[model samples]
Target: MSHEVIRHATMDDLDALAAIEAECFPPAEAASIYSLQSRLSVYPDCFWLLANGDTIISFINGFTTNRPDLTDDMYDDATLHDPQGEWQMIFGVDTDPRFQHQGHASTLMRAVIEDTRKAGRSGLVLTCKNRLIGFYQRFGFIDEGLSSSTHGNVAWHQMRLTFDEA
Candidate 1:
């Protein structure tokens, strides 16, 4: 098995992606199996997974959007997907515990950022907990304090990485 960066995730990768998600986030914060199906079938280009020797390592997935804000609906609403949307909205980034601190997550994010730019979109956006605001800043994501759309009833900090600046 070879270790290399990959472009897109296939449906066969669901189980591995799910395993990483389970370990990294609570069930409430993680996307569901149905949501994964939606992502795989409808937005394959938006989902990406990295592997080491045929074993899944880390991944990041999201879709392009016309809207600037990342509302809760984007997570569960498959019908709301717009493949041609202007704003590249990222949903999640997860890496296996053993693979942490190895720059795998950052590698996947760079791919996503490049894809968003090639698509000629306006920008990339995401929402994270307050504690993670600084973490994203390191990647050049600017925090837009107090996002309006609440996820799981918690306050989310909206982050944007414009095509021009990021």
Candidate 2:
């Protein structure tokens, strides 16, 4: 396996990030360029990019908030991001289809989990379809069952991973 470098995102990555989001999700589920820009502007540090050489192949992006659950509002409202918040709310874990099954998404997810723990966050939260519940559990996430998010008018399940202090 080739080593992919993980780093924080920047304004320069706007186009690439938007492109990747489009490729990874359906139109109804994808984040718009404007929303992505807003997130990058407010909390780039929370957006982790996994790159193979200079091209980004996968990423895990989210914002921090006191809210324990992942909500639809957090996806569009950058103001909801609280840098000092206790929980990390993941908005997306995207990987280019060409790179699927290569473990890039898992690798990026682990990096996000580690970074969140180091930031002293109480836990990490996210929402996904039932199909992905098992996938997330491999990383210690506890499935909280169906979510209230009607963001894209699709059913979502909320999952959380809490960290214990050493």
Candidate 3:
């Protein structure tokens, strides 16, 4: 692992981020370039990118909303983003295939979690497949059984990590 830096996204990263998403997910499950553009424009601060030198290798992008669950509508509509919302809804955790297993995704995820906590969010929410439940649980996200979302036509399980205010 050569010195990697995690930072918030910018419009300049749109192409690289879209390419990574395509590589990490199937067309049906991946976010379209238009969708990515909308998100970046609306909530760039919520998108964390992990870079090795000048190359972006992984990222975690999401939006804040009062809704506790991630719905398919949120993926395409940046209008749903609320900067002061109570929940941070993680839409994707993308890593370049070559960067997998190097903990890049984990590093970005931790950054997002800490950033959200510091922002006074009530919690963080995400939807993942069955195989990823354990992976998310390691981050303290509790599986809330099956999700109602049919995003990408795939079955998803809702996971949440709540933060208690002192």
lDDT of 3 by residue, 6-108 (tens): 8989999999999999999999999999999999999999899999787999999999999878999999999999999999999999999988998888888
Off by over 4 Å in 2: 1-3
Write down the TM-score of every candidate.
0.92, 0.97, 0.97
* Candidates sorted on lDDT, descending: 2, 3, 1
Residue range with the least summed lDDT across 10 consecutive positions in model 1: 1-10
Off by over 4 Å in 1: none
- What's the lDDT of the predicted structure labeled candidate 2? 0.93
lDDT of 2 by residue, 56-145 (tens): 999999999998888888999999999899999999999988888989999899899998988899999999999999999999999999
Per-residue lDDT of model 1, residues 108-153, tens digit only: 8888887778888988899888888887888889998888866767
Clashing pairs in 1: none
Cα deviation in Å at residue 71, candidate 1?
0.4
lDDT winner between candidates 1 and 2: 2
**CA lDDT of every candidate:** 0.83, 0.93, 0.93
Better model by lDDT: candidate 1 vs candidate 3: 3
